[model samples]
Target: MPKLQGFEFWKTTLQEARYVVAPMVDQSELAWRLLCRRHGAQLCYTPMFHAQVFVRDANYRRENLYAEVCPEDRPLITQFCANDPEVFVQAGLLAQDHCDAIDLNLGCPQMIAKRGHYGVFLQDEWELLEKMVKLAHEKLSVPVTCKIRVFQDVERTVRFAQMLEKAGCQLLTVHGRTKDQKGAFTGMADWEHIKAVRKAVSIPVFANGNIHHLTDVEQCIQETGVHGVMSAEGNLHNPALFEGSSPPVWEMAEEYLEVVQQHPPCTLSFVRAHLFKLWHHTLQIHQDLREELAKVKSLEGLSEVSRQLRLRCQEEIAKEKEGAEERPRGDLPFPHWMCQPYVRPPPKVLVPNGQSQGSEETKTESHKRALEDSDGTPDSLSKNKQKKKARNPHKTFCLELKPKYMKCEQCGNPKGSKCVFDLCRACCKKKAYKEVADCPSHGLRFKTKADRQRVEEERAGAIGDQEPPDGSQGLPETHNTEQEVH
Candidate 1:
């Protein structure tokens, strides 16, 4: 049968989904997708799989997409990150049978994505992206789609979307942030860029980012004129965000755990991460349970910890009802026990006087600063580096505080302090082999070879000094003895 494309594919195969759960790395597993689907999610994407790995590794394919014959996970899209056109097509072919469409990931901005030379790193290479999408569209039975981060310039972003559409991309998901807008700098997504891309493309467009609630989804569609709205971090915190209800954290947590139970062999780490996001606000109030959640190893253990947390929250709720406690909601619109969006605090900016502008500093930042003050290291050092220095005070990372390293005479590399040849390990090995010498400091042993040679020489000399078996010192003496006997 001929494959569907563009609006026909969107309307028929996808049912014109408007509320989409974005493709998260480890978080959007089969169990989580099913849970979100039950809570009114119109569509979902499988976690982004490495194209090369997915093509070669059968276990990866089974564990991710073909874990079971899940009929409920319909109208799904399997996404992949790839830089090669052929490999991307191969992966798409492998995944196309299972999903309604195959999505090329051009939205990831993590350091891993950068190192792998895929994802947003390939955004500037328009030719490669075009070839990859076009090849997949030509080869696979399913429609080809792309999820991309916007360029800083709106015109360029719109042109990029248009190019994808021309290259056989049936659908496009435009995350309204540049590649650089990630981590702590993930300020706010620009709806203007998404709106522009929606205008430029003839295919179905999905607007991603800045969606924390169902209201945001409605507002985004109304503003951007896109067919759909996708959410990642917001969905993680509140799975029912699309349902237009902020359910209790325990309710979501327990339901997710139940869904996880149905999907056997679901990764414990993924389940743990989901629980952490669900109980993020509550964990702030009950820090002890947070530790327990992190330390849990099994699913039952996670459920038990969740149950304990539920009891604690119920007790707090009882107190609030009786007017015995006046718990402050702080910045949260609802109480901490309810599921809501986790608003990322803005990045702290440093003033000219070396003080941060924001009075509210994270615990990690404060710990890092305190460590720096005591260790005499610059505050510019990373938090991890500061923590490492605090753990091992004697270890010096500063070049000024480090002991002088002696250079090898033969090579410029650093030499062992106790090396007899005064050379690096490589140079020392060569010199030792040539001179029949031993360098114990460098673990290079040449003495055994020399000893074997000496033994062979001594054996040869001893054989030459030995008398004949007939007791004849010379040939003349042997001849005279024979004549006297005659």
Candidate 2:
């Protein structure tokens, strides 16, 4: 709760005051705010709006400040423009239930500001701004705060701070650039100027401008000696910047896919742009040549590119498995799985005695004969392919007929080992089979009785005094913990 200093809540403090986020209209919508909140932004402000409009138009509020926020988005501010003290106060009071504080925007510098008689145009009108602050303090129960630009002259800016302080505004946020410095090159934010304001004002001061990364937060704190830092464009590019992470790929990639699903399919251009930033770091350590990665242009393309790169990267990671020493790639022999089997079983073998003497040499001779008798050109792959012209007598000896015991549907490998309930190990591993352990979930694999038993044991064990590890807990009702009295 903010301490009641007349109308201003003097004691109310921000939770993550060390790093604050500056608001940008259109780009900084509710979706963006939620993203930032999830990514570690401590404090946030909505884009500056006309207080009069925020109070009057339902559609405007719905489109702008009306966010269906989660509980975690608390301790946030929504900024509004008001040349009139009453307008400012009413807007502030109305915004109290939804936002933590209402920031009075006296710093916006666009042509609209001049036309609306708000923002930078009102910088010269100190008394009106002061009065707006006064009414904001007197009328609104929330903390009264202001966001401003570094003045045209340092002395004049100091005077502006003094005037706002006299109006009962308890906190001031200074964007270190001046009115002339619109867009990127207006000027670098002067930590010196922000420090100057901090020295002059008794209120909490947050230094804004050029805070894009976690390191910037520290540097800004060192330079300005203000209460904290606020960033606008910087937050847009890397939302997790405050926490010192480069960015999270897996979670955000999943979110981007969700956005694509709900908000209509995004253009390939957008996905490529987003993923480019994400995979730029991935590219730094990837073994694939940069030229190979450069060809990617869409989600699918990037997916393929990222897969190829990460697959190779996985091999590198596997090399680093504990106790395993790295070996030269050239020195390693190609795996045995890569080679083609030279022998193929044939139903009959002709010996000089006109009888059967089946051996590897005869099998090799039969394999060559079968391939030679094949319809098309015999390729290197023919040696490994099953000899279609002949069948082996041993197959009947080995294969357990299907539809009884679970049997291999394709190439037979040990008939007794049923892919119970006819499901292959691969499929069972994925579908997490129970009753239908023999069947494949989709098509590629099958579940087993072992899988079902393990699942039942786990399901039974999970009840009562147990908590599942994260989301690995199976369905509650399906996993009946109790057995029959029998």
Q: What local distance difference test score does each model get?
A: 0.89, 0.63
By summed lDDT, the worst window of 10 consecutive residues in model 1 runs over 362-371
Off-target runs (Cα >4 Å) in candidate 2 are 1-13, 248-486
lDDT tens per residue, model 2, 241-276: 676765334345445545544443344544554444
* Tens-digit lDDT string for candidate 1 (1-486): 799999999999999999999999999988899999999899999999999999999998998888844899988999999999999999988888899999999989999999999999999999998898888889999999999999988889989999899999999999999998876667789999999998888999999999999999999999989999999999999999999999999999999998888888799999999999999999998989988888889999999999999999899999989988678999999999999999987646533543577454332111123333434564756767766777787776666677999998887999999999899999999999999899999998898778988999999989877967776666673467656798
TM-score, per-candidate, Cα-based? 0.77, 0.53
User: C-alpha displacement of 105 in model 1, angstroms?
Assistant: 0.7
Predicted structure 2, TM vs. truth: 0.53
